[model samples]
Target chain A: MTPARRRTRSSAALRVLFAFAALIALTSVTAVVTHVVNTSAGLIAIRGGTESAATGDAAQVLASWTLLESMVYRSVIERDAVERFPDGTRIEFRSWLNPAFITGGYSADPTRTGVRGALIGSLWLIVIATIAAVPAGVGAAIYLQEFSAPHRLHRAMRESVHLLAGVPSVVFGLIGLVIFARLLGPLTSGAIFGVRATRVPTGRTIVSAGLTVALMTLPRIVIAAEQAIGAVAPRLRLAAFSVGATRWQVVRDHVLPQAGPEICAGAIFALTRAVGDAAAVIIVGASTVVLTDPSTPFAAFTALPVIAYQWAMRPDPSYRGLASAALLVLLLVVVVLNVAAGVVRLRARRTR
Target chain B: MTQDVGVANERVDTLSTEELTVTYDDIPVVSDVTVGFARGEVTALIGPAGSGKTSVLRALNRLHDLTPIARVHGSVRLHGKDIYDADVDAFEIRRRVGMVFETPTPFPMSIYDNVAWGARMHGRPSELDAVVEHGLRRAGLWDEVKDKLRQSALRLSAGQQQRLCIARTIAIDPDVILMDEVTAPLDPISTGKVEDLILTLRPDYAIVLATHNVQQAGRLSDRVAFFLVDESRAGRLVEWADTDSVFFAPRDARTEAYISGRAGSDMSARGRTG
Candidate 1:
């Protein structure tokens, strides 16, 4: 190749190399920061946070610390050795990510504490948000982009969607607190469903908080979904219309399916933003300490982010370590969801 | 100049317009234009850009209904019935009078579905495979896509995709087909293929095409309507006749200038105000 062409190709390769390096640096920074914070908190809890020096919990914690130290020796470690009696009945697992710490219910003791209540409640919130947000956001995006007559009101509404994105997440929480929690208290708190006691309901239910999160993420979903729909070729719509498909049919069969993957990717990102937010749910009346495994939409709930925020603020150093562990769980979930969205986008592009 | 508005006889015309006027945002784009398309014949609308060739073609298919600001002020008749009547469904009218666009438009679906989609919409699912094959065969795309019916239509070349769009349009068996510069964006070979396909379709359906390519019109059209911008900045049908008379005989000086490429240079500057 000529020198000029060779220079251009080399520059392109260098740009790609720089991009990969930047992405790797970003991931490494996050991992390193998390490790430092979690390890420092664990060390503080072990050295200064235990209430009584001679308590059985402290002794067990020390014993587990010794086993954890041995784990550093890769070639010499007991991968699975639970405490057991001579009769071989297993006593317990001695690890941070043990089943007790993942699935066990509410606990005051540090050894047996788990995220089950927060985990299940957060899942309920996701379900509620998906149900409430996807239809409204996707439908509005399609309608506004495809069917709305382009006049002053139409342009104003489209412009206001960007303004909505500019509003802080906490503002939506306040609105939800007023509208869904106070104004619609009877419906959200299940008082209308006969769960009300003699006292008035507070409306601190999963559905209310979920709706708050849904409201918080609505604009982002709309923006992303609109972009996806707009990216479709005009020729496709004309072709569908010329084939005698009705307006609804054109959107459903041609436009929607073509834009599905991008829309889903946008929804996933919007949900990721919602899933990490604690301020909104807390403002909408999530109770971190009294969290229960929500059985219905109207039940009181606490999400992982809210509980982590609460734990991280406790005076007890032990709670700090637990907070880091909770955050690690939340982090894992976010990573999995983001990866799924990437795969969806890649599959859609491949088909195109 | 000899006017051929009489060619669009009420009894003989398969598709005809009577003093059709199209306006957008209260501005007339095409004014008082009357034309007809006969069965098994090709009619070409030739004009400079922005002179409302596309707007007139869109009115024929009732596509202007999709645009909120566009209004039709004259009657469009199909099979002796006014299509713009209060009772006539625009969707049903469009089904009977299909359209193909300049850009290749294939649905984001399997090749089979693209051809079968219109038929499926009419609630006729019987013999879908046969219907798809017949449509593709007529559009000259069956042999290229037969083994890969499940492949996405977008994976085809631009020329092949254009043919796929043609197949998709014909699959529904509409009585009239409108083409707005269908081969303008294709390579020469693909353009040739599409032109040949249009000739094959001419004997089976009434075809109305809006084109800037003079040779394609000369090669394929039986009748030609020459449109120009009037002093009021609205597109008007200045000349209409058999291809030979409009091209060879003395008629309107404007049509002669356009046919001889004399008006091609600055006509577009006037067309913009239209």
Candidate 2:
């Protein structure tokens, strides 16, 4: 080979070597930091005589590297270790995630504290929010992108919707508080609907909270959906039009189906935002300590984020550990949502 | 040129436009154009770029209504009915007058669905399979695509996609088929196939084709309307006559200059020479 070719080969090899070194360094630093954090948190819990401190550390380390939290928890439960602390306090190691932990209602008693009720309530909130937002958002997007005339009023409406997306979630919560909780109180609480059941005492129930989150994320869905619809080729619209399709038929048959994956992705994004939202839910009077499953839209509700936030604010070590576990669950939920979005996008691409 | 209008009325023209003017945002692109298309005949609208050839073809089927700024004046009559009347639905007008665009545009669907889509819009027809087969065979695509009818229309070659679009138009069974530079983007072989398809389709549909290819126009059209951008940059009909007369013995000097290679040259020089 020529000198230049040889030099090029050496440079390429050097680049590969550098990239390998960088990846190794990154992994080592991350492992060292995680180990330090887990060890310190564990030692502090132990000093405070928390029963599940050691197991919690093991679970955290396992969760950090892999999906082995359940295995560690199971091992700890089976061992049933009883150890005496320096202060002569006897502690028993136990699994933090049990069926009772997943399904039971909240309790102020630390031993019985679980997020099952909150989890169910949050899921219901997502369902309600999706129903409230998706249709309205997608419809508004279709109107703006496909049918709306290019006039000042329509332009202003578009700009206002875009502006609404940037507004704080708390502001929407305030709007929900006034409109849903107070103004529509009787209607939402099933008093006017003739159900004769008021689960929240006040009208600040899951219905109100769900609507609040829906309002908060409506603009995001509309913008995403509009962009998706707009991205369809002008040729496709022309083709459909040339074939004698009406405005509604063309949009329903060609435009909406093409934009489906992006619409779904946007809905998932709205759900992710709603799932982690605490301030709006709090303002809309989602109970901080709900003890029963929300059986209906009129029922009182709490979500994992609220419980996690409440737990983190407490001055107890065990409460902080519970908060960490709750955060892990929230992260898992977000990952699952993103994976679902990916599958939808893949299917959409394949359809074309 | 005016003599053709009298003859146009004498014959049972399938579709006709009277003094049709198309404007976008109040600027006229096609002005005061009177044309008629007879059944079993190809009428080619031959013009330069920006001469409003596509606009005129689009106006025939009311496709310009989709553009927010476009405004079409005068009447486009299909089967003696004024399509621009307030009570007339544009969709119904389009159902009678289908169109094929310059670019191939197959819907993002299966080949069968692409052809069946138009027929199914009213409701499911009892002989749906027969209709799809007829449309595909008429467009000369059935032999190539018969085995993979379930495949996505997008997976076809560029030429095949254009043929699929033709099949889709034919499936609707329109009285008049508007083709806006339909073969402009195709290869020579594909263009040949499409040109053959257009000739085959001429027996049943009043086909109005707009194209920049003078040779293709001469090959396919029975009568040709030559449009030119005037001093105002508004497209106006310079000459409309039989294709042989227009191609060989043109009446208008501008039509001759455009048909020849001297279209963009100094008009004043040609005027002084004449």
On lDDT, the leading prediction is 1
Report the C-alpha displacement of residue B260, candidate 2, in angstroms.
2.6
Per-model chain B TM-scores are: 0.94, 0.92
| Candidate 2 lDDT over residue span A85-122, tens digit each | 33323433334444555666676645456788778878
What are the clashing pairs of model 1? Answer: none
Model 1 alpha-carbon drift over 4 Å, by segment: A1-100, A191-202, B1-11, B230-233, B269-274
The TM-scores, one per candidate, come to 0.82, 0.84
lDDT of 1: 0.81
Please give the TM-score that candidate 1 achieves against the real structure. 0.82
What stretches of model 2 exceed 4 Å from their correct place?
A1-104, A193-199, B1-9, B264-274
lDDT of 1 by residue, A1-352 (tens): 9999999999999999999999999999998765744342222112222333245444233223322243453223222332222322322324454455668776776655788888887788777898898888998899898999888998898889889888887898899999999999989888888885232267878889999888877888899999999999877888899989999999999889988999999998988889888888989988766535677788777888988888889986566666776776777778888999999999989877
- The residue-by-residue lDDT of candidate 1 on B109-203, one tens digit each, is 88999999987888468878888999899999998989999998879999999899889888888888899999999999999999999999987
DockQ of 2: 0.70
First chain of model 1: TM-score? 0.79
